[model samples]
Structure formats: structure tokens, C-alpha cells
Target: MPIPSRAALVEHLVRTRIAGDVATPRDNNLSHYRKLANGDRHYWLGLELGDRWTDEQDVLAVMAERCGVSDDPEHRAGQDTIDPELTVAALDRLAARLRKAAAGKERVLFATGHPGGLLDAHRRTADALRAAGCEIVAIPGGLIADEGMVFQVGGVAVLERGATLWHTHSPVPMAAILDGLARDGSPLPDLVVADHGWAGCAAQRGFDTVGYADSNDPALFIGEAEGTLQVTVPLDDHVFDPRFYEPMTDYLLDAAGLPV
Candidate 1:
């Protein structure tokens, strides 16, 4: 398939529910913003939000500006949005970084908390980067983290517990991965492509990190707001079909000038 044009990509985003009026409820979005304001570190993903984001309104403002949610502090129910244009703009920015990584043959690490939804996207991007001369960083061993073992599968790291690969938002796995690399005397990645806590923990540790985020996940946007993250693309990270992401990723790679 050919890469989608910007207008076509925007249409795809809304039509397939990747952006626009997403499934995440307005109440749920506000609840997360409030929690982040209340210093619930879980909502912080992995960054230390501290006293800066104490006001829920402030958090909402950041989300609206970056994630394209509603800015109205009074209207707090029903449907919320992820602006397709903002999503596209951020995708372009993320692509810029990927392009640079490919050109420089930089070491890149890719991870995902939404394995069921985003693992394939990460894997595809990692493969492209690796083939473009970027070193696809690997986990040293099956590192135990948060009671689950981290394993690299199909070019991305995911946590497996029991017989199931788990979906997680905790930064412990990323912490464990970074620690393992250090212990093995391996050089750290020049760039990390990830979502959820994987991206957050890396940004908090001062890496050039870029990734996606849902309307409810505000930490990555806040991280970008505070200069901790390189970029954060606003979208519904998980949709009804994982296939919906293919076009978006293709749009990204296409924009980045990577072979798609």
C-alpha cells in the first residue's frame, strides 16, 4: 500500500477512531487529569510531576494543547476528542526524529506497554530502523520486573508473566531494561520509541524519547511540555482493531522518508 497523504491520513484517523471523537469517555479523561494533579504517581507514568501540575485545569490545558482534548473546564462529560491535525503534526515531528536516527545509524530501542495493540507497530518500525543501519538495541536477558519477566519479541520488549504477555503502565520494566544494559557495559540507546511507562521512564532518565499517548494518558504530554520528552503523538493508542494503526505507522514512516 502506498503512504497516505496528510488529508487522507486525517480522514483515516477519524474514520477508524484512532483520533477525533475517541472511545475514551470524558469523565475518564478528567479523572486521569485530576489524579495527575493529585500526584498519583501512577498517572505520572514515570515522570516526577511534583507540584507543577497540581491544578486539574492546568493538566487539562496541557492535554488540550498537546493531546487535542476539550479545553472547556466546565463541560466535563460525554465525548472528548483527539484532534486529528495535532495528531498528524506530532506524527510528522516524531518522523523527523526517526529520519535522523536512520541517517545517523543511531542505537534505537523500542518497547510497548500496549502489546496487544501496539507491539506490531513497534516491531515494524524497529525492523525498518535496523535495516536502515540503526542498531536495534536488545535486552541483555529476561530481566525480572514488577513480578514479570521482560522479553524481546519480534523486535520489541514486552513483559511476560505466567503464560501471558501482560499490558503494563509501570516504569519498573523500563528501569530494569536500562539497568541491565548498564550492568552489561552496553552503551545506552540514542533514541527510544515507546509508549506508556516505557517512554516516561526513559524520558525521566534523560533520553531522547518519542511515543504515542491516549486521551487519558497525560504524562507523556506533560513530559513534552517540560522538555523531558522529544515528542508525544496524541491519539487513541488502542482501537477496536490493531490493523487501524498500520496506516498511521505507514504515514509516519512515509513522512520520515523511511522505506515503507
Candidate 2:
């Protein structure tokens, strides 16, 4: 895979509509921030946030700095953005962690709540890390959580129910993974690469966790702020085409010095 230049990645992000005036509008973004501030556990994404992020303005500030959203509370209805530079910068941080995992030959678990959009990216990263001597943590079968069965497809953990892969924001699946590993005397992951509840729960439990988040999801960013999460990259979690993530993933792997 060719490594995309910084300029090229930025262009891809804006042109592909993954960032820069994205699909998630400002009003929806503010709504989520408000709910998160009001102590909605659903917005907590599986972490026990307590009162660390109860201020709507505080959450908006983090999103603006880390996610490139507008900080103005008055700007409630127009377009929002995921700054391409911040996205690339956060990807650099994520790559640093993966590079260390590879160098240490560490046990790394990769999971995704965003199967439709991020599955390929996770798979590509996992495959690269495995090739570089990291152990891709196994997703144990028969594991169920959050009313959905936990399963692995193409080496990435995801939630499934009713014979369909379900999109989830619950951390129960990660808990099940850890519990299952303990029961079998298997080693816990040295690092967890995931998003949604998977990343939140792992980080809460003190694991080295890194993952991605969209503009509306502020828990991972809060976790980073609170010193629990390693790093969380910001992007639109879902683009209409899964293939849209290829360039970003390629850039990430390249930055991590891992061969595809």
C-alpha cells in the first residue's frame, strides 16, 4: 500500500466527505454533547464517567480541540467538521501505540462496534501487527453480552444478534472477552484497539486502550483527558463506503512502519 502524504490524506478526508463539513451536523453534535453532560450512561459508552464530564461546554471544548467541531454553543444547526489535521495527528498517536505493540510482540485485541465502516480498517491493522509479531487476541466463541452474542469475523470482534451483525455502543462484550480469557487462563491483552464500549471498558479496567471516535461520541476523548485511554482518533465513524477508510488505514500502517 502506498503511504499517503499528509497533504494527500487531508485532501482525501475532505474530498471523500469523511471530514471537513461532515455528514453529522452541528445540531446533532450539540444534542449528543448535552445528553452526555446530563449523565446519560448510554452516551458514556460503557465507562463509569461519574462527574468528570458533566459540563456541556467542557465536552464541547474537548470535541472542538480534539475533534474539530465548532465550540460555539450558539452555532447549533449548520455543518460541523472533523479537522483533517487533528485526524492525522490522532492517527499518528494511534500508530505509535501500535508500533510499540508490534515491537514488543505484545498481545493486542482489536474489536469494533462499527462493523459496517471500520471492520476493514481493524482487520488491516491487525493483520499488519500480526505480521510484525504481535498476537491478535482471539475472540472467544459463545460469548454473549449486552443482549447480543460476541463473535469474530475476519479477526475482529463485533456484536451479533438475530443472525445479523449489530452495531453497538455497549462495553458488555469486552467484559465478556476478559472474563472468558480469565476462565481459560489465557493472557489478557496488552493493548486493546477498539471503539465504543469496547474501548471505554478496556480503558476503564486499566488496559492500554486506543481507538477511534466520531464527533458526537465524546467518551473516548474524555477518557483520554482523564488519563485512562491511550489515544482516540477522531473521524466520522461511518462513511457511506467502507472503502473510504482504506487511505487512512494505509497511512496509519505506514506511519507505524508496519508492512502491509
Candidate 3:
């Protein structure tokens, strides 16, 4: 695959609703923001918060800065937006992190709550990192309970030489994975590349973590703000065709000096 030019990637981002005119509803963003501010654990994913985020307005401000959502609280029932430029900028940062990991042959793990949308990108990234001689650690898998549901198990999807896990929404899956690794006395991952609770939990546990987020998901942004998360690419995470992300994958791999 040919890496996309910056201009072309930006255009694709807008055309696919990854950024610019995003498909995430404003009300959904607002609801999540409110829940985050109010200290909902499910909304928090895994990060602990200080009093700095107790107010909804404060959360909204951070969301505006990090996720490119609207700053205005009154505009509540329209389309939520993510800046394409911010998305591209964060992707560059992610590439830089990948480059550093590749140089060191660091142990890394990749996972996603958004298996239906972002798995392809994670899979491609894992392949490239493995080719660069990095150790892609696959944590053990199990049936983990969901944080928000009373009787549901968020089953883990381990893939790519144990480099990637997918379809997990709760932090329990990650916690269980970490526990299993510790019990077996395996080295912890040097870096974790993931999204949603997987990213938040890893970052909170002091791993070098980077991931993608939609405007509606404020937990990763909060984690980034608190200095736990290393990078977050803001966009509509699951609204578009999965193939639309191939150019981005190519661009990021190229930027990391990996084979595209």
C-alpha cells in the first residue's frame, strides 16, 4: 500500500467522517462528558480523577481542547466535531512513539474496544512492529465481567502473535491480562497501543500508552490530560468503512520508517 500524502489523508478523514463533519451525535458526547465529570467509573474507564474535573464545564473545556468537540454547552443537539488537523497531528505523535519502540525493540501490546472498526489498523501496526523486531506480547485471555453491566462477560480477542487483543469494553479484561502476566512472571509491556478502556487502564498502570478516541469518549482524553496517556488520535472511531483507514495505516507505518 502506498502511503497517503498529508493533504490526501486530511481529505479522506473528512470524507469518511473520521474528522471534520463527524457522525457522533452531540447529545451522546454531552452525556458522556457529564458522566465523566460526575465520576462514573464506567465512563472513567480506569483512570483516577482529581477535583479538577468535577464540574461539567471543566470537562467540556478539556474535551474541546483534546477531542475537538464543541466548547459551547448550549449547543447540545447537533453534530459533534473533531478537528482533522488534531487527528493528523496526534497520528504523527503515535508514529514517533512507534519509531522509538521499533528502535529499542520494545515489548508492546495492542488492543481495541472498537474491534469492528479499528482492528485492521491495530493488526497492521502489530505486523509492522513485529517485523521491526519488537516483541509483541500477547496477554492471556479470559471471560471478564463488564463494569457497566450486572451479568455480562467481555470476552477477549487475542490476535497477531499475542500482539493485539480486541472487542473488550471493560478494564477488567486488561486487569486480568496484567494479573496473568504477573502470576506467570512475564515482563510487562514497555508500551501499550490500544483504545477505550484498554488504553486508559494500561496508561493508568504506568505503561507508555497511546490510542484512538472519538469525541464521545472523554476518558482517554482525560487520561492524556493527566499525563498518563502518551497520545490520542481523536476522530469518529466506528462510523465509517473499515477500509477507509488503510491510507492512515500506510501513512503511520511510513512515518515510523516501517514497511508499508
Error of 1 at 58 (Å): 0.4
Per-residue lDDT tens digits of candidate 1, residues 22-79? 9999999999999999989999999988799999999999999998899999878999
- Identify the runs in model 1 with alpha carbons over 4 angstroms from their true place: none
Q: What lDDT tens digits, residue by residue, belong to model 2 across residues 58-107?
A: 99998998899988888989898999999999999998998999999999
lDDT of model 2 at position 260: 59
lDDT of each: 0.93, 0.91, 0.81
- Compose the digit string of candidate 3's lDDT tens values, residues 1-260: 55789998999899888899798889999998888888788888777776668898888998899878889889989788898888998999999999999999999888777777887888889889999999888665443444321111122233221333345556765666776778888898999998888788888898999999888888888888878899989988886589888888898999999977
Rank list by lDDT: 1, 2, 3
Candidate 3 wrong stretches, greater than 4 Å:
141-168
lDDT of 2: 0.91
Worst 10 residues of 3 by lDDT: 147-156
Tell me the TM-score of model 1. 0.99
What would the TM-scores of all predictions be?
0.99, 0.98, 0.90
